[model samples]
Target: MLPQHDRRNSREVFIGNVPMGGNNPVRLQTMTKTDTRDVQATLKQCRQALDAGADYIRISVPDVASVKAFEKIKNKLAGDGYRSPLIADIHYRHDLAIMMAGIADKLRINPANFGWPPESKKKQAKKSGKSEIPPGLLAETLAPLAEACKKHGTAIRLGGNAGSVEHTNTLTKTRSAEFLVNQAVKYLDILEELGFYDLVVSLKNSNPAETTEATRLMHQRMQQTGQHYPLHIGVTESGLGVSGRVSSALGIIPLLREGIADTIRVSLTEEPEKEIHFAQKLLDVCRQNGDNVFEATCRDNMLYIISRTSDPDTLIAEAVQGFLTLPERNAIQHITIEAPGMANQQVVKETAAQIMQQADIKEVGTRFISCPACARTSTDMEKLCRLFRKELADYPGIHIAIMGCMVNGPGEMAGADYGVIATSNDKVNVYAEGVCIKRNICGKEAISLIREILIEDDSGR
Candidate 1:
């Protein structure tokens, strides 16, 4: 049995009829990848996620059309007898977020872009050398959204991404855990000043270590400010397949064990239902009572993870749970998995290495960062990501990103050494060290080009 720990005492906040935090079970959420304008398709994906045990479903509301479509999708779900809460994922436009506040059960707005000045005003501010938003102007911009949310009884999530923080606040000009926390807290403070207390917070980074660190700091900062709003924890752009799962586990499990996360989403580069399923498995391993299904032992700086079940997913979850919750994780220099009934020791070893690598304790192979392709994506992102992974398997220590679209791709994958972002169904922008080196190249040709870049880089080294 794992040692018992107390959950952070967050105040209960309701999303539609569902309550999160304050002794509520850790909630699971997933977002629809379908276009919001495709009401039927979006509704279908929402139903799939709900059926898979998600407590909340988020749909991207990228533009005015999507906002209208989201309203239709919400009504359709209601007409079909589904009562699960729907969250509107809004970016770039505070007006869209304000519009969503009246319609969605929850509005997820990025703090980096939520109340920032428009480009014209931004240029003016730059000329005047004003780095911070004046208090009155900030209130003027956000007050309407706050009032709208309050009128509709909708909760707001001030989600900060490490990838985009540099674009907004001068205080967050350098992207670090402390800077991320500072940016989020500034927004939270303004929201509180506006008398909007129904809030959830999230700080995500593509790097698992940064995500973990930033969230931990956010929790502490909230406590200091006497803000007990629930936390929604996730690692953005966790990629696809086992790499995605391991990365999610590494970033999330430790926080879950520490009792910091009130709700969680595992952002995988696949169908929404897959994310829900993976979250279920992850939650099972990190239940609040601290009664894990696996046993762990450590000797001579080597930790051995043992499980009775032969199921690979369960074993991986157990290993993650066992490794992350250790009191002296840094003291353990190695990990060995013992699943005698399982025939493939190689799988076990690989799983262990992945866990270690994702935790930032070791670097076993190449790192992949990918986003859950949303309606904004133009290409077959899942297929492309798999192909890239298969082709780039031998480049250990290199970080590559397979982003679905240009919207958040370049920013979210800022840490990747090399990356590709789809500009259209057939064309992509290739990136090296966060700078776009090639634009609008054929998607098929991008793979070879990246390989050549990698080979050239290696040879130069």
Candidate 2:
């Protein structure tokens, strides 16, 4: 069993009829991948998430039309007897966010881009040589939305993405854990000043270690300030398949073991229901109070883990939990796993390596990162990602990103050596070293294009 820690003291906040934080069990959430403009498809996806035991269903509302569709989807779900809360994922427009506040049970806004300076304002600032946004501007911009949320009994999540956060200090090129926590704290202070306490905060990074570090720091900062707002924790753009699951586990299990996360989502490049399933399993593994399922023996620099359970999934979860919660995790250089009667021990060993790599404790092979495709995505992300993996398997140590859409794709994949993002249903944009090299090419041709680019780069072209 994982070491138990006391749950953080947080004020209860209700999203629709669901209560989060405080003493309530950790909640699970997943976002729909269907286009929000298609009410039936969106609703159908929401039902799948709910049926998979998600406490909340989030829908991407990128525009005015999506907002309308979101309302229709909400109404249809309610009419059909689904009472799960619906959250609106808003990135750029504060106006749409305000509109969503009145309709959605919760509004998730990126502190980096929400209420960003308009083009007119930017032009004026450029001409006036006063580019700095005036002090109190964020509060002024968010007050209306806060009031609307208050009136509608809706909660707000100040979601900070490591990829999109604007750095005030150009000296720091990378978005560090300190920077992420500072951003979230800034937003928390603003919302508190506005007297909006029904809040949730999340700081996500594509890197699971960074995500975990940022979350722990955020929790510490909040505790120091006596701010007990709930936290929504997840590793954003965690890709797909076993690697994705391992990444999610590495990022989340540590927090859950420490009783830090009040709610969680396992972002995966697959069906929303699959995300729910993995999340549930994660919770089960981390929250167990029974006898430990793993027996570990350390020899010099390597740790050997033997599982009491023969079940593969449970064994993987147990191994992850056992390895991560170790006090001497940093001292260990390698991990090996054994399960009695297990036909393939190689799978378990591979999973152990993945867990270590995902946690940033070791480097195994090629690094793959991809977003959990949302409504903004237009291509078959799962298929494309699989193709990229299969065709590029020989190129170890390289970082490749297969993103779903351009909204946050380019930014999220900033660390990747190469990336492919779907710009439309049939077209994609390819990137090298964060610069787009090809635009609007057929999706079917992206892998070949990437292969050619890789070959050229190998030749020092």
Candidate 3:
């Protein structure tokens, strides 16, 4: 496994208020799909995105003419009480990058500018009949832009993209990503020459493998060049919905675990908020890394809990479902997930069942047994029991139960580590190992006692 490399010494810059590079947690940035010309609608999204936990919001600044929405969005954030960093996504026009630096906190520019400065065509490469863009050409052009950003103390996203019209000769997926990395590095090197390093790097491609490969190569290239700059990684053009989430997860997770990227953007066809939502999860966990240069690791060993709400299961399952698939169907040796969204329920429950069930659920911890408070249950004992669950929510690896009475408490909590069997006696009898451990417990410490006992007895199966 590649050791987690502490962040490279890239100068830290803030977008809105979120910081990137340096030792800051990786920033999650997304591009708004809204037309920047519409101030009201654009500000609406800026608010909606902040509510969804987006660390940084990026607006497409196409020309000097469309600066109204930037101010409106900024005003909305100020008036509505949102402080998430706002980033401006610009392309081609160096003037936009420079001008926006004064208005916006950051600028995302394609180093190549899609073959601007007509002279680049000749200076980039010897006239090969086949159209091949020399990645260095983009960097040469970006030198002035980098200098401008340095002057403004503005952060710059050297967002290198190979999908532009200039990057038209993408013979294959690998080559396309290769072309992007070269373009980004060429641009980054220009920053280096100018002694400006307030930048983050990204190489986005639709193919997960290509994206992964490109990042791997770029990291190696940076290490060799002794340039410790932060990286922003994700699979670009990922189709919308679950498929897109899966694609980004497959590519971004491994890089994150190996300590490859400092920030991320999951490019989904859905709303920009959706991308930001997924991006936060990526930041919450570490990514998988491996020793082999070719075979990459996509998941860590720790089991993660995914809330079924908010399409969490679908989005996350698709990313790490290899060993956790449906019916446990795929071959045993074929369990490795090379990319994202590889598994389903069959893999998860079946594999977990086979391993844990064989050893028994007891090996893990207590299986809490509790009933939803309803009219069918008694009020005092049952209601009091339900409210006390908070006392043990953080205590993992233990089973605890709060049952009403003989009606269903015993049946429901047949195998709990601690069961409160309420009886006609008004005495609380604690059941341990399906046998009564205590009765008539009269204190606020009942939950605490059960918690201590459960944690003591359980061993991971």
Candidate 4:
């Protein structure tokens, strides 16, 4: 459960009817891995994701065939009653973006690719002995695309990848948080100059730490410069299975805890449906926590309360507010309200009606056990441990120990399915089923290794 933290206010961008940022629910997104040109396969995946609770879906539109397929996929889904927003993920092809502007609910462009000097500009730069494209020309090239987006009411995600930095002069470095921030700011300047405000920012890298730092840096800069654009945070190439899930969580959960990101994608090398599930669960854990709220989970039943007050009417009202905040509200069969004194029956009935009216539970999930960081710890052990516990809470056979010490102290990690020991240098050693399987792994890798071991063992059983 996330401690009810204040959300960072950001500019809201609408994708279809769903609102993102500005205290709106942290939206869930997943990209289809199927060949975009295969309309049947892509439509199948998109429908599967929407059924799994994906707020928005993204599909690559890299070539002309993919564009046509996207159009078919969109029409088919709309025909079948899938009204969730569809995003066109375009790379380097501004023409495709312009073409997709009228079709897609959102257009996600790789800023580094969009900013890269085209062949003509490159040849001119070579002739002039210049290392970069002239700023005016780059802006001119992007303006038409931006204008197209505005005319079509298509939101844009200015996505920056670490791998793309080497190809563009906007940033000459990779894995550096500063470079990531600069790259995003450069493209943001272009959009702002053309009066484009329907934008979100994403800075992604394979390294979880780099991803976190870059996002935090970008969020800080946005706050400082009075830029409220929503941020989309994720780690690129976050692997597969348990390893990918944990690494993605390590990178993403911290910024989310800080209320720095508005939407998240766990870029796992797995089925796109799994990514949606992970991101939705993470958001559920982040949005609903406070001392005034209480949740008790035992087996399939749950007991929840909205307390920290003395008035019966206030207690009932708070309880309704708390219940409505949960993503799993309807899944809960029975809710018992606790008050300091006898509550009014009328108030209870009205509040219950309001909750039932607003409640739309998605699925059953888990509890959280998070701690604060200490000087002795490496990585954000607190966030990692919380996610570890939450992800594996359903497995009663698995016992996990998240220890910050480099060595076992006072028999704290015995009889555990997994044991993690943190070092002074932000590295962790993983012990699986009572034996060491991997060591000297960074925090990002530690979660994945731990998850991988658990999944392997569970499969064996």
Q: How many collisions per candidate?
A: 0, 1, 22, 2
What is the lDDT, from 0 to 100, of the residue 267 in candidate 3? 71
**What RMSD, rounded to one decimal, does every model reach?**
2.7, 2.9, 21.5, 14.9
**Tens-place lDDT digits, model 4, residues 1-461:** 23335678889899877878875877889988676776887888899989998989998887888888888998999899988899998767777899999999999987656764557765675587544446677688789988999999999999887645524332233447888788788778888999998999999865566788899899899989898899999877544433345446667767887888788887754567878877765565455532234443323445456354444323433454455455564577666555444345544443343333223222122212111122223355545565565456565434455665542211234334566676657677777644677877876687777667667877997
lDDT of 2 by residue, 290-351 (tens): 33467877778688888876555566667788777677887888888888756667668778
Candidate number of the best lDDT = 1
- Candidate with top TM-score is 1
For candidate 3, give the lDDT: 0.57
What TM value does model 1 have?
A: 0.93
In candidate 1, what are the lDDT values of residues 327-349, reduced to their tens digit? 88877789998887566777688
Clash count in backbone of candidate 3: 22
lDDT of 1 at 357: 81
Model 1, which residues run further than 4 Å from truth?
Answer: 1-5, 118-123, 130-132, 166-172, 288-292, 331-333, 340-347
Ranking by TM-score: 1, 2, 4, 3
Tell me the spans in candidate 3 whose CA falls farther than 4 Å from its real position: 1-11, 118-140, 165-177, 284-461
Go through the candidates in order and give each one's C-alpha lDDT.
Answer: 0.83, 0.83, 0.57, 0.67
Say which prediction, candidate 1 or candidate 2, comes out ahead on lDDT: 1
